[model samples]
Target: MEKGLLYPVTNAYREDQKLDGLWDFKFDPASEGEQNGWAKGLADPIEMPVPASFNDFFTDKDAREYTGDFWYLKKVFIPQHFAGKKVELRFGAATHRAVVYVNGQKIRSHEGGFLPFTADVTAAVNLGEENIIAVKINNELHRDALPAGDTVTLKNGKRMVKPFFDFYNYSGLNRSVHLLAIPQGNIYDYSTSYEVSDDQATVHYQVAADSDADIKVSLADEDGVVVAAATGQKGELVVKNPTLWQVRDAYLYTIRIQLVKNDKVLDEYADKIGLRTIEIKGHQILVNHKPIYLKGFGRHEDSIYAGRAFDLNVERRDVNLLKWIGANSFRSSHYPYDEQVYKLADREGILITDEVPAVGFKMAAASFLGGLDQSFFDGDWIDELYKKHIDQVKDMIKRDKNHPSVLAWSLCNEPDTSTESAVPYFTKLFNDSADLDPQKRPRTFTLNEDDTFETSKCLKFPDFYLLNRYPGWYHKWGYEISDGEAGLRAELDEWQNSDIDKPIVFSEYGADTEPGLHKLPSIMWSEEYQIELLEMFNRVFDDYDFIRGEQPWNLADFQTVEGNMRVNGNKKGIFTRDRQPKAAAFYLRKRWNSLPLDY
Candidate 1:
């Protein structure tokens, strides 16, 4: 049975919780178990925390990097009072691939690092006794893993690699781990689809369950007023809207589903669904029949304290800063984010573009193509990588499709260099998404620039065209005369005049700046430089009509190997790394909200 309730896992670094402790670890070079016979036999034991990487157990020299199979073991006990309860083992995240074992019995295995997966361990756990949990993880860097290509050193002594992107890849249980107790028959998965007409609105509720139980479903407004209710033998219900939800109106309704067995409410789940219509026509993005511009930024799911580990306070801080800056949207850059982000976006009225982690080039492909070198495409790994990426996309859409804030399903980020190979993969993903839910259309891949041959080639595959243009930041235009405003206008005009005939989104555009660092106007990552750049872009935005939206390079200062030594990434956030607001914060908020800034 699929366990559907979302539960919080312990943050990976709680010293007092005993969830972050040392564990017995061994690496296996062969496909078969040979290192310590741990995978086959479970006599010798070591201890590890629920939310830790194998590197935690290794010494300095041995832990620097990991690139093979590593096994982890830990003994946990379920209290006698907790016995006879339905217990499930949930993993917040694990890198590459992982197989889980409980008491030496294989329970489940999963692939991917940014999403959550679970296994029902009630049957495998010995009731009221100590149970051993083992996890085997495999990490292999391959090309065709997404963005294809290699490494380079810019003139400023800054380095750029094929992960051609930013952010460190911290392998292991980087998210969270939790043990949940629930009733025997419970709600598995719940999703809602909304449709609106002139008079009445219809919402379809689909639910999955573990047993044939009676389910009660209800729809209520912002206030606790029920507008609809129904009981079903199977897990399906329908509701008619009393008041629909829209961005301008920002009205949301809650759909609550409760499982009833033997005259008792066993488990309950509720989804916050908004009623709205989104359409793309010409070069405008319309929500509920009104044109709206997406003044936003691209985001990475990394924190200074937790890295990629789950931290609710950090997530709240990120969303709060976005609202404070007057930005209305964000792109989950390069990868899908925690599910909670989507819910917050819905509640806060922020538009979002959810993306998958189909990034980087493999080593072999980089050598063969002489382009950017990324590990995602190495060694004839296209089919496997594509399948894995597709699975991640499916999981993302299925889990978060009902969110009103999700504007589009971004297939990939700046996968320009490998257009030919990436197009088919994106097409399949788009088609599959359409089949699953017809409410949202698949937005094809995004390109870094408009003139690249790859961009023109892949234009036909997507429903809309999104270009990531940073002319003032990257082009060879003279620094003496800033092209910040002119560059944006020129790129928008070029795309508007192009024969692609698809709506254009300024997918990425922004400059980086240290929050309080003052420097010369020409230098990047300084408050002065970032403000100048943003002001120019904001002016162009005021005059342009062809562009539908603009999502700046980033929302907050994120950690990047290249960013550390040389501010290589556009540190162009309205807030600092610790979420302190910068001077540009007020400027962006004013522009996005159509308010005039005195500065």
Candidate 2:
């Protein structure tokens, strides 16, 4: 079975409940919840909003940064009429680890912090009766965990969430929770990949069912006209003179899969699918066989109080901002975003570089602090991390494979690829992902400035290249303006000479600038300096044919761990945390609007 089988039914033709809004919440700091039987019911639980982070609610900073077990309890009343149907409790996402219990009985558990998980509550649920849906959530990090970190106790005897990467570890229910009363044996999974040639489309599709049932699949255009229809478990449907999905010119067709028997529609499932193709050819990325340029930012599914939760109000604003800035593509950065983000991208013709939450990944935490050695090789730890890392890759690929917006799959972000021992890990991961994806999207990983093609043997694994370099910010900070440009140019020239025929995108590149800070001479933390650095980088980007895309470090300022270098968070965003555009946004808007989307 595919890893996506773990995901909820996307195209359920039956009735379901959206378990949004407020729920009874509590923090189990002492870890005595099981002994106290908190799962049964909390004695004095405070009301907290669902689909948002619990960190931002408290007045104390310590409460906001708590990393241990927290509970979200809700009482749901299932309708008596839906008793015969199979009901499920689906969570959009829970932080690092989650345990679900229904009516005091443990139902299921999931480990991923950003992926959806479901539990069957048909037997546990009391129809027409109020039932307790209790969830015990934890965000403590282990070395073996994906995006590994550690829980450290300080000299004062206080534990802290010490992350290996940047960004605040906001924990809670970050996405929607659903109560799906779907049919017992309905269409669970289906996907479509297409071959489009301007005027024609040949769509290959597959459907998975719980049991044997006659299936009728149809392709409907925007006009609600069925272009092609078929009957089978898997087959091809052809449409003459079909419209192709394009960046900023997206077109889509509805795929309706119906379960039929004896002239009766047993159950039907439907979703909008875009007909597009992606390919790679000699240092260029092709969309629908046409070489295209990617113009966008590396955005996170993050915000003020919601943290990583999915909010349509914020989502719509973000989409409008991207469109207003003349951007046609974006990377999910270190993690996969909510499913609705992809849906919006598909409709607006926005391209995507779907990524996994494999950030903070390294050989081991001890290796970095012990001797600061770059070449520490451990057989046992490598195997353990690889096992955990590859599982996330499969889950990410399977859940996001069908989206037209996703142009490629990013295995990780800025991992320790400079080490020689890391070569086998990347190679193995890339190979494992190839087998899981049906779309066969080009796979790549983001490389930091330290990971050079010459030094890192792991560089050979990816289909393309993505480097995160901070020229003016990190390498040539003290150099004069002209000298810094030359320094950046030198690095690019060396990369151009490397002779690797693959598309290279600067997945991250920017200097942290305080929003209103400005100086005539241009200095660090100054707005002028930020604009100047970006303009210089853009010039260098234009000069290289192999550099197909340039996504600045972030779309907006986001919360991160408290440190001297960080003013609340990473200020590398073109916009502030509230989505207000800074000097960089305007600069990119003008440049992106003027550039040709195709090479």
State residue 521's C-alpha deviation in candidate 2, in Å.
1.5
| Reference-based TM-score of each model | 0.82, 0.96
Give candidate 2's error at residue 323 in angstroms. 0.8
lDDT per residue (tens digit) for residues 211-241 in model 2: 5879999999999999999999899999999
- Model 1 lDDT per residue over 1-599, tens place: 12343533222110112234565666554545534557544445445444544443455633424455667766777656545556777766776568988877788888777677877788888767887777787654444343333344458543334344455544577666666665566666766655676556667777777767788888888897887777773333344535666553457888877777789776677667887777777666777666777767888776654456556788898877877676677888877776778778888888888887765432322322343444232336678667776777777676567788888888776654343555565566666666654476446667755335333445666676667776666563326325655655666676656665556667776666777788754466567776776766667766756656767777777765333333633365667777787877776777777732111
TM-score, model 1 to reference: 0.82
Q: Clash number for every model?
A: 29, 1
- Candidate 1 residue-wise lDDT at 95: 69
Q: How much lDDT does candidate 1 score? A: 0.64
Model 1 Cα shift for residue 431 (angstroms): 2.3
The parts of candidate 2 lying over 4 Å away from their true place are 1-13, 363-380, 478-484
